[model samples]
Target: MKLLSRLVIGLVVLIVLAYAAAVGYMYFNQRALQYDPQGPITTLAETTLSGAENVAIPVDGSVVNGWYQAPAPGKPIIVYYKGNSGSFSAEHERYQQFVADGFGFVAFDYRGFPASPGSISQQGILDDAVAVFDWAAQKGFPLVIWGRSIGSGPSTYVASVRDAKALLLETPFLSAVTVAGERYPYLPVALVMQDQFPVNQWILDVAEPVLIAHGTADTVIEVTNGERLYQLVPNKDELWIVPGGNHGDLWARGIWRQAEPFFERAVATP
Candidate 1:
């Protein structure tokens, strides 16, 4: 009987130690897991970003680098917040579409990515987002704020605090903690996660029209996040769940069909 008791106690101790180890790893490596800014360091000389001028905006001891292309007269501009992966140089096709539609665009690389050098945190990115919005606001054109993937955090936060004609979220999550929970159901992710980009809560404060697009087959961030955020938006615009679309294919599926019209109607004077 004593031998069995000792065996049971040993198993329990092992389980406890393993859980603690997992928690420690997640806590320490959370930033690394959440951010991947490494990709081709693109230059204006390399891509077909026609009529785009390089822009630099100073914020919090760092300069965020961006590209700005003026729209044709009497058109709105899209202040684009890129996803958590590559530099905005890779967003050429989208920019081309904007140009074709006579819509201007302002896109930038977040700090610690490519030409912009600094550390990234939730508050840090959010602050940069506001600074960028302020810069774009100077152009005197109607604005549409578009956020994709990790960009949703800053977009929702900015939308709550600033006024824009529209807010667009593509392949977004409820929050950083929520994504961690989904990815690691065994771990106490909410307690351990440090970068909690609470898009769900921030979205509740946005007063402008909001359009959320997510892929039904998006494994990076699930479709359910979009569904829940859609319900939370104060001025819900549209929720697009692309059949079998993944994280990066919404544009290929002709999202521009919905987006162009949405932009036109959003800025239309009533």
Candidate 2:
């Protein structure tokens, strides 16, 4: 009986130690999981999209690079925030689409991404976004903030505080904690997750129109998160669920049909 008691105590101690280790690991490494800053890539000018110009934003003592093209006065301006991977050039086609539609477009690399300086943190990205938004807003154009994947966090953050013509989120999660909890049911993500965007919370405060597009087949962020976010919005007509669409390809699956009308409504006619 003595030996059995000792073994039981030892097992309990082992489990406690393991749990402590996991909590420590999560606290330190959560930032890495939140931000994926791929090293620098091609400049905006190199992409060769006509009328594109390189803009510099100073944030946290570092210069973050961005691309901007202003449309005619009174046009809608898309302040686009991209996903985790790839440089700004990866979305050249999308930028072109905005410009071709006669809307001004602005996109930037997060601090640790190529051409941008400084390590990325949740606050740092938000700061960078506000800086860009302020810069664009000064031009006196109506702003529509667009966020995709991880970018949705900052997008929602910005829109909640600042007024926008509209806010668009693609493949967005309810919160980082929610996603981590879903992925690791055994772990305590709610307590340890560092970069919880709390989109559900922020969306409540947003006054402008919101368009949430999520793919039915998205395994990465999952479709349920998008649904939850969509439901929170007062107006249900703005939600777009692309059937048979995955995380990366929802835009290809008739997203533009909704996008065109959303833009039309968001942008005021001169």
Candidate 1 deviant stretches above 4 angstroms = none
Residue 146 local lDDT, model 1: 90
Query: What is the lDDT of every predicted structure here?
Result: 0.88, 0.82
lDDT of 2 by residue, 41-96 (tens): 77656665769888897766777788899876767888999888867668787887
TM-score of each: 0.97, 0.92
Candidate 1 lDDT, tens digit per residue, 1-270?
999999999999999999999889878988888898888867767767668889998898778998899888878889999999978778878887898889999998888776578988887889889999999999998899899999999998999999999998999999978988999999988877878999888988899899999999999999999999899998988998999999999999988888888888899944
Off by over 4 Å in 2: 235-237
Q: Ten residues in a row with the worst lDDT in model 2?
A: 39-48
